[model samples]
Target: MMRVKNFAHSTFATTNHQTMADAQALLQKADKKAASGGGGGFSRFFGGGTTNYEDAAELYIQAANAFKLQRMSKEAGQSFEKAAAMQLKTDEKDDAPNTLVEAYKVYRKTDPEDAARVMESAIQMYTAKGNFRRAATNKSDLAGLYELELSDIPKALEAYDVAGEWFSGDQAEALANKAWLKVGELAALQEDYARAIARFEDVARSSVSNNLTRYSVKEYFFKAGLCHIASGDLVATKRAFDTYLNLDPGFMSTREFELLQDIVTAIESADQELFTEKVFGYDQLSKLDKWKTTLLLKIKNGIEDEPDLT
Candidate 1:
């Protein structure tokens, strides 16, 4: 066993050393090519200088892949960035953003801040080229990085909102709604009920006119109602619920609507057990996601903590 372990370790070390060496060699070659392409006074005057930016960019990309093989993420990211810059200097402007996206992917595993910065660069390039769909996709990715890695909820919300608008402009309504849903969820998390409600309602209203998204309107209205409940405004919740029922008479038949109604009754009577029972019943049929469970718990707790006014 010890002999086998030692052999494995030796092989791993040898592979890593070779990979690093290869990356360094490629990087040096790329640097030399880039320097040669930088037309100096004499080279420019003599007209003998021909930019090797394309070759340098290819070498940089190879170096980046080699660095990745050695788990050197930061080095890989830097190499990819160099490749992107080289590509930008050449006529391959389209490929430059893709190279930067590679850098963003590399940085994402270890350095979220760097990842966000690189992704923003790619997004800007994409937008500048009128590739709004790709820009929207990257913006959604940026929003995830901000929310999950950086814990910057506000930035995440903003990014999602922008992504939704871009997707809508591109006639990608389904994708737009997906991004808007993230904005709604994040807003709700921030306790910005008005913002959350508006987003959910807007999506629900839009979805009601489309056959593909019609079924989802109930869930959106349910979420909006929950947000209203969380806001401690029962009147608004009831009014919104009435509007939802009128907008889609079918919503009244869904278990989501029933749960909303039960929750409202529970809150009105300060019946914590009824609230828990209703949620548990619905959950048994269709498991509640973490977000929904959290909101329900908040509502239940609020009912329990209500002060007597009699």
Candidate 2:
């Protein structure tokens, strides 16, 4: 007989190892009944006409914990996947997607391909249930997995856009903004300046319209300006700067903002030396971030060649 580890008013948290052993034995019994089409499995476990796959799912979860405790990552993930599948077969649809996500977490560290597969299953389940918020969150996770683990930028970008669409449709403004920001950043990384600028501008306008935060609008405008600078569109950068000044009530004439105007002025006066010096000066004072530095370098490279568009 197994000794009880702890007991409360109406429940207990058993010792995991003992529970694992018991669950393994029960799973064997369940597997035989499941295969034989006997009365021992889900169809009769709860004494109801409705199936009760929860018993099998609980056993699978216990087995997963056992494997995880033994440091067998692959087996643990497989067991969790089994649990998720069993959960889906039950009447509890909401918990099934969550169970699949648990399997995904187990697989993510050991096998990204397996993780991606599990995440796709979770996404489908959530979408089918019209749980757009959860679906969008899972899509964002999948996007990160593709970008960071699988090194698939195009797929990552596509996933982010899909996540953004779901968030937007669900009227989740903050989440939608985050998803679209990823899409914009990826577009900028791919040197698609126009698309990046458009995405940033849209978010910035939305932020203003919804009265989200002035700082957020400033940051988006900052990003849009960098993208315009990257595309060597000095006129557009100036216009974006003007729009930011108009919107931000707390606007100050910082060197970061001034550099945009200076760069425009330098190009109009045909002074490549002045443009370079002003940009470098801003870097010395404010220390540009890597993304800003990258776009600034691109601007400096083409500044002398591109005619004044102001």
Candidate 3:
């Protein structure tokens, strides 16, 4: 809690609104003094009775939080940005980047556009400082905002690709794989199976080469095979499985591999009903929800073009 300053034996406003008003007044006075390049009274009231950019930044942050208590997100975000700028100006390098991220989060709660702008600012700051890891992380967040908040798939994919590049440059292979996985998902959402499979294949290979989680490699290959099958490329599906076994030879005996083999056999026999029945009867496959069943049906639809009662 901020203690009310006693001036001339008059207690400063103790109410939240009054306190906020006083803080803003101080902020404005400081701004005026800052504009004229003259240290002002606001500086004297800050911690240690010394007015400086760093102290002004803290004051702005306090005012911003007071505004936030009243549900004023935009003002709060603006105040945080000011704090970040002042932190940078004071050569407080370590805290500057994350302060901007804090502002971006506040903006994201009420204004996605402003959130993206703030993130871009943070990215630029991080990049200029050669902090590629943080830049890549922020780029990934920006990509998510584009996808989920802005509903712009192309921009989201572009953002992910750029983030992946930065992560790769930073030798953060796991993070790079995550970005590429998202890119692959977006490609699949767009029904660009070839592109999706290609990205999935790339990530899967990288995961194996980097010796990341072993199970994920099989999952990636399975997803790629699904895409190949959905796109009516049985030969590609066979090759995908072959590649998977070669990479993790032990996976060849897993139920997932058996399921793949059964699926391939069903496709080769051109027996859509048999494929559906075999898939539904498999105990492990029963775990697959309806959407996946629908995708498998799409692959079955490719196997045979016919209109008849099941």
Candidate 4:
């Protein structure tokens, strides 16, 4: 067993060293090709001599792959960035954005800021090319990196909002709704209930016309109601609830509607226990997600924050 282990370790070390050397060699050749400013002797003779960015880009990609094989994510990401730049300089503008996406995927594992930066470049390229769908998709990804990786809530919210608009303009209502949901959830986290409520209401209104999304209208209105409750506007909450019922008449029969009604009643009476009970009861039947739980807690806290008339 010891002999076999020793052989395996030797083989692994040899392979790793060879891979490193190969990557270095490829990188050096790529640099030389980029600086040469001429394709080759034959191309010069044919009057077609020019900077060989195409070859340089391929070499950079190969080096990036080699770095990835060695688990050098940062190096791999940098190589991919170079490849993307080279592709942009060549006639391969279409491929440059994809190369940047490759860079983003690698950078996200090691450096979120770098990932966000490259993703923005990819999004800009896609938009410039009139590929709003791809741009919107990357914007959503960029928002996730900001929200989850960097914890930049404001930037995340902005990115999600832009993505939602782009998706809506592209007629990708489902994707737009998904992005808007994130915007609403984050806005609520920031105590921007008006923004949250508006986003949710917009989604609900848009969804009511689409058979595929109509079923989710109730959930969106429920969320908007929760935001209104959190904002301590019972009158507006009641008004919004009435509007929701009118918009989706079937919502009045849902457990979500019941919970909202019960919570509104509990808040009016300053009954925290009743609020908790209503939420708990609804949770037992239908599990509340983190966003819902958070907003519910905020609404519950508003009860205690309210001044006692007595």
- In terms of TM-score, the best-performing candidate is 4
**RMSD in angstroms between candidate 3 and the native structure over all alpha carbons:** 6.9
lDDT of 3 at 82: 78
lDDT of 4 by residue, 39-157 (tens): 65887555323447888889999999999998888988999998888888776879999999999999896899999999999999999999999999999999999999999999999
lDDT by residue (10-32, candidate 1, tens digit) is 99999889889999999999998
Off by over 4 Å in 2: 1-52, 209-212, 234-254, 265-273, 304-310
Residue-pair clashes per prediction, in order, are 0, 0, 1, 0
Q: How accurate is candidate 4 locally (lDDT)?
A: 0.90
The whole-model C-alpha lDDT of candidate 2 against the native structure comes to 0.76
Which portions of model 1 miss their true places by more than 4 Å?
A: 1-12, 40-50
Identify the runs in model 4 with alpha carbons over 4 angstroms from their true place: 38-51
Flag the better candidate by TM-score, 1 or 3.
1
User: Model 3 residue 294 lDDT?
Assistant: 59
Candidate 2 colliding pairs = none
What local lDDT score does residue 14 receive in model 1, on the 0 to 100 scale?
94
Candidate 3, which ten residues in sequence have the lowest lDDT sum?
A: 1-10
Model 4 clashing residue pairs (backbone): none
Q: What is the lDDT of residue 213 in candidate 3?
A: 68
Sort all candidates by TM-score, best to worst: 4, 1, 2, 3
Off by over 4 Å in 3: 1-16, 38-56, 85-96, 209-212, 265-270, 282-286, 289-310
Whole-model lDDT per candidate: 0.91, 0.76, 0.76, 0.90
**CA shift of 289, model 1, Å:** 1.6
Question: Scored by Cα lDDT, where does model 3 land?
Answer: 0.76
Among all candidates shown, the one with the greatest lDDT: 1
